[model samples]
Structure formats: structure tokens, C-alpha cells
Target: MSWTRKDLLAMRELEAGEIVLLVDTAASLQEIATRDIKKVPALRGKTVVNLFYESSTRTRTSFEIAGKWLSADVINFSASGSSTSKGESFVDTAKNIAAMSPDVVVVRHSSAGAAALLARELPCSIVNAGDGAHEHPTQALLDLLTIREKKGHFEGLHVAIVGDIAHSRVARSNIHGMRKLGMTVTVAGPPTLIPPFVQELGAKVSYRLEDAIGDVDVIMMLRLQQERMTAGLIPSVREYSRYWGLTLDKLARHARPDVLIMHPGPVNRGVELSPEVADGPYSVILDQVSRGVAVRMGVLLLLAGRKGGDGG
Candidate 1:
């Protein structure tokens, strides 16, 4: 299938073949990182703008490096230092950026429909780095790539995603992407943290951490969002850790010997996973980070490298 979409706004909106194509593209580009001169001319004259309304270390930097590696001019914009801090509306700021004529605008915003709004308003190709509790498509793609690299396939694999389901965009994107590609997903967390209608999104909800991890091929632990930890979502971090946090003992006793451990990071250390488990042999957390660049590079090439692809 040829690439047709101008914007990647959400995982739920993509077809299974589209997802597979993205993962395969990223897989082919992974070897570029090992070259003596880590650069490619696929996007030589393209311009990618990282328009971020929220603070990010991994996603923002990953896009910058990805564009640079593909020989595209990458410009990063932060809301804090830009006109957004001086009462400039999101639309106004975006319009100003659009006038400069970028090939791709990778955006991360605090609003759920921010990327969609940009797709509607801007002529440039849009990539959603993340939107408020909505989706992070590239993160899910890199995760799929990492899984394929490690486990060799996606069909019929069971993945247990544990922690902060209600506040996780990564979980939402992963659930949609994985289910479309024939993987089973079980989202596990406290009842307060697990959204009521996750099953409607094609995921099995489990309250017990042990029950969720047992017999699964992959265990993806999510970071507990401390900012979103309001009045009653969780009683205490200590209590949550004791019951829900993944430990070496939990892995040894409950999870399968060949089960892969993963996390979309800025890991909370002892809250979502123990230090030992995060650094353990079964953990592919670092692989996910490296795959992030390759995934972003693939996205840039597809969306910006098209013929007659000129943006406002």
C-alpha cells in the first residue's frame, strides 16, 4: 500500500495494513543508526517543525534527531518560551508557524484535539506526538517494532498493560494498534485508575496485577502520572506499589519466562516498576527509546517526502 495520509492524528483512525507498513519502514531504516555517518538523504530538503505546547524530553528530542538523521532541517518550538506564554492562542501561534511553510509539523499539546485542529487549519502534514489522554501513534508504532524485533510476530500475542490506564495515551494508542494487528490486550490497574469503558475499546480489564501478567507474552508497565493523582484515584504510592508495582518476585512467580517487559518512559522507578526489574534482562525499555527515532524518521519520510508536498 502506498502512503496517502497527510496527517497521523490517532492510532484508532489507522488501518492494520497502514500500521504494518509503518513498522516495516522503520525496521528498514534502523540500520542507518549503525552507519559511520548516521545520515540519509531521503528527506534532504524537507523541514520538520516540532511544535510543542507541553514540555517533553523524549518525544520532542526524538523527533529532532529523527529529522536531522534524515537530513531534514528540524526546528523546535516550545510553548513556554514562545508567544504562547504571552497569551497567544494556540490557533494564532500555529497559523504564524504555518505561514513560514514547513513540510511537517509534529505537535504535542495539552488539548485532546490539538493535532486534529492543526490538520484542519494547516496545509502542512501533521504528526501527533501526543494529545491529552487521546493518543500517541508513533510511540505505539515503535513499541510494535520493538515487539516484532524481539518476539518475531504480532498475531495472537497477549500484552498486559498495567498502571494508570485512565490517564495513559500510550495505553489507548497501543490497545487500538495491537488489537487491529491481532494481539490481545489486558489493561490492569486499580478500579479507580482503569476507565469504565476500556472494554468498549477492545481491551480486557483486570483489577489484579498478578492475574494480568500471568500467561502474557508481554508486560507493558505505564508510568503513574503523579500530576493526575488527585483526591481518590489512588490511596497512596506505597499502597499502589505494594499491590500494583512490578517486582522481580512478581516476574519470577507469575509472568512467563519469555515474557518481555516494557515501559514508555520517564519511569517512576519504584512506583510502576522496581529498579531491579527496569534494569533486568527481560526489560526492553532501552530498545523502545532507540526505536523511537527510527519510527519518527519513517513517519517524516512518508508524510513529507511525497511529490508536490508543499505546505502553507
Candidate 2:
């Protein structure tokens, strides 16, 4: 089968067949990550550029590690110390990077559609690490892999994604992926934190998280972006937790001992979810981070294709 290059901006871009291929490939790559010699030859000689217009350590470092594991040459760009600090536009910076002829560009920027904008102007495939509150597709993919490894299939499962729904790109992407995989998704948070029209996205919406917690198959919590907190979108962490936090009491109300827990990392601990819940048997949070490396490798190799063999 010919490997078609996939630009992973959102779960909407993934078809069933493609999801299967990517997941299967990622599972195989996971085995490689377990080996003493962690590197793989699949993307030897490729050039992978990590272009970030925002600050991050986990996502950026994960992408860089993924690229290096596949034997790709990697360049990590930061906005603060780079030419972007000199007032260069994103397009200009992308064009300049493209001049070096990278096999793929993994971009994360503060603007919602920055990666898509870069995709339109660049020759290489684009992997949207994140783009504002718009989407974080790979996070969704890795989450899917984590759930699949545990629950086997998403169909017939009830998933409750609690916390900041309005501003979480992870939640947005997970909603799409879960629905596509035939899971029932319910988003729960304060009225202000959830988009009023969230049901239009095929998810059941609830103002009180308790309403959606019962007998659910998965509990997905999102990080509370401090920027959102400072914006006063959420009144205060104490108030936010009272209304939306996944406390021990909340988990008990769900009553499903097997209800798998998940979170995209840099967890706020006592804020979004309790420390006990995060470290509980139900939590696959750490696995999500580990799987991130493999999922990114799968995406990078797929996008790079045979062109990666040239080390461009």
C-alpha cells in the first residue's frame, strides 16, 4: 500500500482507514521505543523542524525526541530568542525554514490557525502540535491509542471530558476522535467554560460534571490554562474547582472502579483532578506521554515518506 502523507491538524482530517494505519504503526513503534537502542531507521536522513511561536516543554520536547528516534535531523525554534522576536511574521519565518527544505514541519503557535496558514505556504507536510485553542490532533491520537490499549474499542463507551471545554484544544480534538470512533461523548464544565453550542459538535453538554459522570467508560480532564485563569474566564481556582474540578468525591460519584482516567499533561493536580485520581490505577496519564513519542514518530514518518531518506 502506498503511504499517503497526512497533515495532522485535527481528528476531522483522519479517516477510519488512516486512523487504523496510524494506530497500528504507532503500536509497532512503541515496541521499538522499548528497546535498549531507541533509534529507528525509518526516517533516517530526514529533516524535521519544530517551529513554536508559544512556550512549551512537553509537546516540543516530545516532537524533537520522536524525530530523533527516527534518525531525523531536528531543529527546534523558539519565538523569544529567534528572528520572530525581531518582528518577522509567521509566514516569513516558515518560508525561511522551508528554504532549508525540511521533510516535515511540526508547528505550534498562539494563533488558532497558524499551522494551517503555514501548511498553505509550505511544501512539506504539517503536523499541528497545537494552534491556540483550535486543535491538538496528535494528543487526541495518543489518547485514542491509550484507550484502545486499555478498553479495546471506543464503540459503546461513554466518555466524560471535564474541565475547560471552551479553551482546550485537547478536548476539542478528543471530542472529534471519540465521536468518529463511535463513542458517546459528554462535555462537562461551568456554563462559561463550555461553549454554548457544544452539542452541535455531536457531544452531549452538561453544566454540572456530576450529570455526566455516572457509569462512564472514560474520564478525560483538561489542564486549566493560566492565561484563561488570568483572563477571568474562570473566576478563581477555588471557584473553578468547586464547579468543575475532578475531586475524589466526584470520582466516587461516578462509581465505576474501572472508569479509566486520562489527562493531557502538566496537570494542575489539586485544581483539575486530585493527586490520588491522577496516580490511581484508573489513570493512563503517564502512558499518554509515553505514547506521545510513538504517535508523533508514526505521524512524522508517514508525512516524511521516502523523501525523508534524503535527509533534506
The model with the greatest lDDT is: 1
TM-score to true structure, per model:
0.97, 0.94
lDDT of 2 at 75: 94
Among all candidates shown, the one with the greatest TM-score: 1
CA-lDDT, candidates in order: 0.93, 0.84
Candidate 2, position 19, lDDT: 74
Task: Encode model 2's per-residue lDDT on 1-312: one tens digit a residue.
Answer: 445654777777677667767777788889877889998777777889999888889999999999999999899988854445678877898999999988889999877988889888998889999988889989998998999999998688889998889988898888888888888999988777898778988999877777777868888988887777687787788888777778777788654888888999899988888898899878899999999999999888778874434442
Model 2 lDDT on a 0 to 1 scale: 0.84
- lDDT (Cα, 0-100) at 88 in candidate 1: 83
Question: 220-248, model 1: which lDDT tens digit per residue?
Answer: 99998776556678878888999999999
